[model samples]
Target: MKTYFRLLSFARPIGRYAIPYVIYTLLAVLFGALNLALLAPLLTTLFGQHENAAAIAKPEHFYDVFKMLNYYSMKINAEHGLFRTLQFVCLTIVVSVLIGNIFRYLSERTMENLRIHTLLNLREAVFNNVMDLHLGYFNEERKGNIIAKIAADVQVVQYTVTGTLQVIFKEPLTLLTYLVMLFIISYKLTLASMVIIPIAGFIISRIVSRLKEQAAAAHTSYGTMISYLEEALGGIKIIKAFNATPYIKKRFHEENLHYSGIMRSMTRRQHMASPVSETLGIVMVSGIVLYGGSLVLSNNGSLNAAAFIAYIALFSQIMRPAKAISTSFSNIHSGLAAGERVLALIDQQSQIKDAPDAKPVHQFREAIRFEQVGFAYNERMVLNHVSLTIPKGKSIALVGPSGAGKSTLMDLIPRFIEPQSGAILIDGQNIGSVTTDSLRALMGIVNQESILFNDTIFNNIAFGKPGATMEEVEAAARIANAHDFILATEQGYQTNIGDKGVKLSGGQRQRICIARAVLNNPPIMLLDEATSALDTESEKMVQDALNNLMKNRTSLVIAHRLSTIQNADHIIVLDNGNIVEQGTHVQLLEQDGLYRKLIEMQTFSAN
Candidate 1:
């Protein structure tokens, strides 16, 4: 019940649709009952067949539908000819049906609008929460599961609100309206026949007993299947290279089969509820014919041939609402299970939220200082008491072997990952005390793998600065050595770059990334092996662009090749999560330490 209500809250201003829906549904039910009740008048009055016609007195209360109908119907028949009375009753029944159908259409339309509004709010909420989560969260959780919750589970949850409406208000009220009319015609028969209702409910509940559990399992399995799909798409190159096509296909097929089996089981159970209820309703109707027909034939009871016939019609329709309610229970279980997954995503809190009193930083004046900073990943230490200073307008290089924590150290400067101990300060102000947006605004980053959107070159270059003109973009492109290659393309700067810049070569892609960073024009730059992935010819071109980009900016670069950082102001050599040496290229060579050994190894590898 709690989960059901929480999902409904997404349909905010629910009264906008609720009040009108209730009114329309009420009118539909009222007129629909009249449509059936008029059968009694047609049988009794028009045919001139009631034995006690003389005893028919005017009903005192206006609410006495059956008595009023009988009184007026007989009055019309006597004053007017038989054909005229038939016209009056038939017209009344026709009008009742038309009005009833109109109101039903209106009620259904209102509910559809409510479903769309709820879906809008729920999808937006899930996406907004997802975008606000910290980077580490994406690393720890599967992307497919997140995508499924945002896209698929949210879809399932919206229908839960509709199901809830049917269970609580729409179907129940309709059922009540039918029952009230049945009791009015013959209360004794109505009272005696209520025994079959609870029995049908108990039997239907047993069939859908496991739907909620299975639905939860199905959602999990779906997420897993989606995860497998993502992995297959992302690693297609590796799969083909190793000839693992058969293995991958077999693995995916097994999960697909499992998910399909679960859905089939759920469908079988969900579908059984309606038939079971309908069959029980027919059984109840058979019993009513035996019991109530005896009362009409005896002629001593209130149940007449006309009224007994009307009673049976009303009783048959009462099962419709009952059947709808049972079907909704099945839907509600599936929805609530999906609702739990979507709500869990919305409930996720980002660990890297700003402090309440965090200040906004605008510019960098002095150096970025790391004072005894330490960090670890899952109990494995990556950086230990690391202290470094990158002064304003100087390029400092960090060179190390694999798993030496250089990238992790660079990530700490931007607060991408916080240090376990100690503080990093920019111009004497603690970075942790500043807003993440303002802090990140002062720096530009470039990774080894070029990250470009599948958009035109002009749009990609001007991504962050939305209002940039062509002149400004051309200037940035010129600085990164990409302006000539861009203009040489068929569409020039307007050329569409395929996914992740696949349309361009490695060097061309790297130049585009550099151009993007240059357009932002931050004073602090972090380059993570920016030119290491390029060939000799491409590397030289990118190296020159890097030289131009770092002319006066304070730069912290992770140098994969020792030759690239030989000209750096200060080079920090690290091994085993600790800085072993710090000096210029010549001074480092004089030390005969880990720095000298690395230079020799790189030189040997190059030869």
Candidate 2:
């Protein structure tokens, strides 16, 4: 219930929609009931007339619609005759139906707008929160499942929640209005009908009792199937290379079947509620007939022939709203289940957040210092009491074997993942004390993989600076050696680079990534094996671009090929999260320590 209400909060200022909807609905219900209530007078006018009929006695209270209708019928018959009275009653029924339908149309329009409004707010909130979540959350959770929650689950919640709310108000009012008229005609019959109604409701509830559980299972199955589809698309090349198409096809098919089965079960249970409630309602109507007929046949004064006939007609209309309420219960259960999943995502708190007193830092004046910084994952230390300093406006390189914590150490600079212990500072100020956005603003990063979006070359280059003009983008592209190829494309810089820059060569994509980082023009550059993935010819061009970009900037490079970093002012060798050595390139070669061995190993591999 709490989760349901929390989801409802997305439709804030609901009174704006609710107030107008209520007015329209109430008016519609009023006119609709009047249409059925007029049935009594119509029957009385058609049958009650005779050759020497006297005037019908008017009820004491004017609110007694049936008696008053008869009195008016007889009065009209004496003056205007039976033909005129029949025409009058039929015309009243037509006008009542027309006005009722108009209000019904207006009410439906208002409800649709409310549903759309609720969906817009909910989808926006979930997506914004998902974007703000910590990077590790994505690592621990599946992308497909998150997409499902934000997209599919949110859609379900919007319609069902609002629809059930509509039923809660509109259906019950309709039922009550019918009941009031039923008792006015014959209280004995109305009381008997009310007794049988609860039994119908009970039966419908039991039939749909398991629908919520099935609905929850259906949502989970669908999410898992979506995840499988995403994985297959992402790794299509690998699957093709390994000749695993059949295996992948079979795997996805199994999940699809499971999801389909759950949906089929849910549909059966949901559809069953309508028929069961309707069937029970029909049974009650049958009983009403036997009893009400006796009252009329017994010449009972409580119900005249006209009143009894109108009473049964109004009673039959009662089944419509009653069936609607039962069906809405099934939908509400499904909606609540979907609501729980969506709320769980909204409730998630990011693992990283700015401190209450955190201040924003603007410049990188001195150096980034790691004072015995330590980090661990799953009880295994990835960075162990590591201490180092990257001084301002100088090139520093980290060279090591795989799993030596080179990338992890570089990630710490941007606070992508915080150290489990110890502190990192910039110009003697603790980085944690600074706002995350401002702290990251001092540095530009280019990763080992060329991460380019599916966009135009110009937009991709200017991504770091949204407002960057053509001249600035061209200059940045020149620095990264991307300007030449960009112009060589069919549209020059306007050429669209398909998904992940697949439209361009490996070298072109990497250069564009460099161009993006250069456009940012931060004081510090964190290059994580930027040239590692390129061939020798492409590597040299990218290396030259990297050299141009790093000019007069503090650079922390994770060198994949040791020969590339011979001129670096400082070379730090790491082994198992420990800094084994640090010095000038020549100084390290002279020491003949781990650095010299790495240089020798790379030299050997190059041959």
Question: Which residue pairs does candidate 2 place in steric collision?
Answer: none
- lDDT for each residue of candidate 2 in 426-525, tens digit (9 for 90 to 100): 9999988899999888888988889988899999998878899999999999999988888999999999999999998898899999999999788999
Task: Assess every candidate by TM-score.
Answer: 0.95, 0.95
Worst 10 residues of 1 by lDDT: 598-607
Instruction: Kindly report which residue stretches of model 1 are placed more than 4 angstroms away from their true locations once superposed.
Output: 50-55, 603-607
lDDT of each: 0.88, 0.87
How displaced is residue 390 in candidate 2, in Å?
A: 0.8
TM-score of candidate 1 to 2 decimals: 0.95
Tell me the tens digit of each residue's lDDT in model 1 across 7-111: 888888999999999999889889999999899888876455634445677889887798888887777777775677678889999999999999999988998
The residue ranges of model 2 lying beyond 4 angstroms of the native Cα positions read 50-54, 57-62, 603-607
User: What is the alpha-carbon lDDT for the whole of candidate 2?
Assistant: 0.87
